[model samples]
Target: MDENGFWAMIEAAWGVAGGKAKPRQRLSEGKLSEGRAYALQEVLEEEVVPALLERLDALSADELLEFDRILERKLYDIDRADIQERTDGSDDGFLYCRGFIVGMGRAYYEAVRANPDRAITDAECEQMCYLSWHLYHDKFGEMTPSGISRETCSNPAGWPPDSKPDAAPDAAG
Candidate 1:
C-alpha cells in the first residue's frame, strides 16, 4: 500500500475504533465493534505496518533514517509519565496503550539508526509488531477479552547471536 493507503487504514481503524487516544470497553461505534480487538489485529499490522514497511523499504538510507526521526520525535511521541498518571481507571488505559505498537516501530527504527546499512529481518519485523499486545489493556480488564499472552508473545524479529532485524532493502542485502 502507498503512504496514503497506509495512513488511510489508520484513519479508518481509528474511525472504527473511535480514534481517541483511549478505547471504550467495547466499541460502541463502527461496523467492526462486534469483533474483539478487531481494530488491533486488522488495522495495525495486517494492514498498516506492511504498507509502511513497503514505503520504508523503497526509501534511500538517508530517507529511512529521516522517516524514523519524524515518526518517533513527532508522530508517536507519548509522555510515559503522562500515561502513568492517567491510570486511575479503564477509561484512560488506551492513553497508555497506544505507545506499545508505536514502540515496536520505534525500536526497529532505533536499531536501523544505529547501523543504517543493516536490514531489519522479517522475523524481527514481526517481533516489533507484536509489541502492541504488551503496551496497554488494564482498562479493558476482561471487558474486551483477547487471547494474546504477554509472557508467551515473542518479538524475535531481530534475534539470536546477531541481535537485529533484517534490512529494509536500502539498509543492506
Candidate 2:
C-alpha cells in the first residue's frame, strides 16, 4: 500500500478495534452512572491483538520489518505521561493504548518474519492483538467514559501553548 493508504488502514483498523458505544442513560436521583468499561475490556482482551498478529504472519520478512518500523515510530512519537493524563479527559487514552498494541504488533511481526518456516494464522494474530489491548487497558485503566473527544484535540499543536505571534520574526521593516 501507498504511505497514505497504509496509515489510513492503521487508522481504520484502530477505529474498528476501538468498537462502538452503547445507549446512554440518565443520571437519576442518588444513582451512580456506570460506563461501558467492562465491555470494552472484554473486547480488547478477546479480539484485536489476534487480528494484528495474523496480518503480520501474512507479510514477508521485509514487509514485517517495515510494519515494525511504522509501529516503532508511532510508539516513539507518543508522549506516555501526557497520554496517561489525557486518559481521564479524552480518547487520548485510546491513543495511548495504541502504543502498547504497536509495540506488540512490531514484536510479533518481527518474530514471525524472522522465522518464515514457522506457521502463523489469523487466530493467533487475533489473540496477540487482544492480549496487547487488554494489557494496555489493565495497565492504563478504562478510557474515560466520555471516550476520546478528537473534535477538540489537535493531533499536533500549531505552536507551543505559551508562544504567540510576537515570537515570530518580523517580516516588515
The numbered model that scores best in TM-score is: 2
lDDT of 2 at 97: 42
Write down the RMSD of candidate 2 (Cα, Å). Answer: 16.9
Question: Looking at candidate 1, what is the lDDT of residue 121?
Answer: 15
Mark the regions of model 1 whose C-alpha exceeds 4 Å error after superposition: 1-38, 85-96, 99-173
Q: What shift in Å separates residue 66 of candidate 1 from its native position after superposition?
A: 0.5
Location of the lowest summed lDDT over 10 successive residues in candidate 1: 116-125
The Cα local distance difference test for each model comes to 0.32, 0.34
Candidate 2 lDDT = 0.34
lDDT of 2 at 41: 35
Instruction: Give the alpha carbon lDDT tens digit for every residue of 65-146 in model 1.
Output: 4333333231233312222222112212322233333323333223323432221111112323232222222212222323
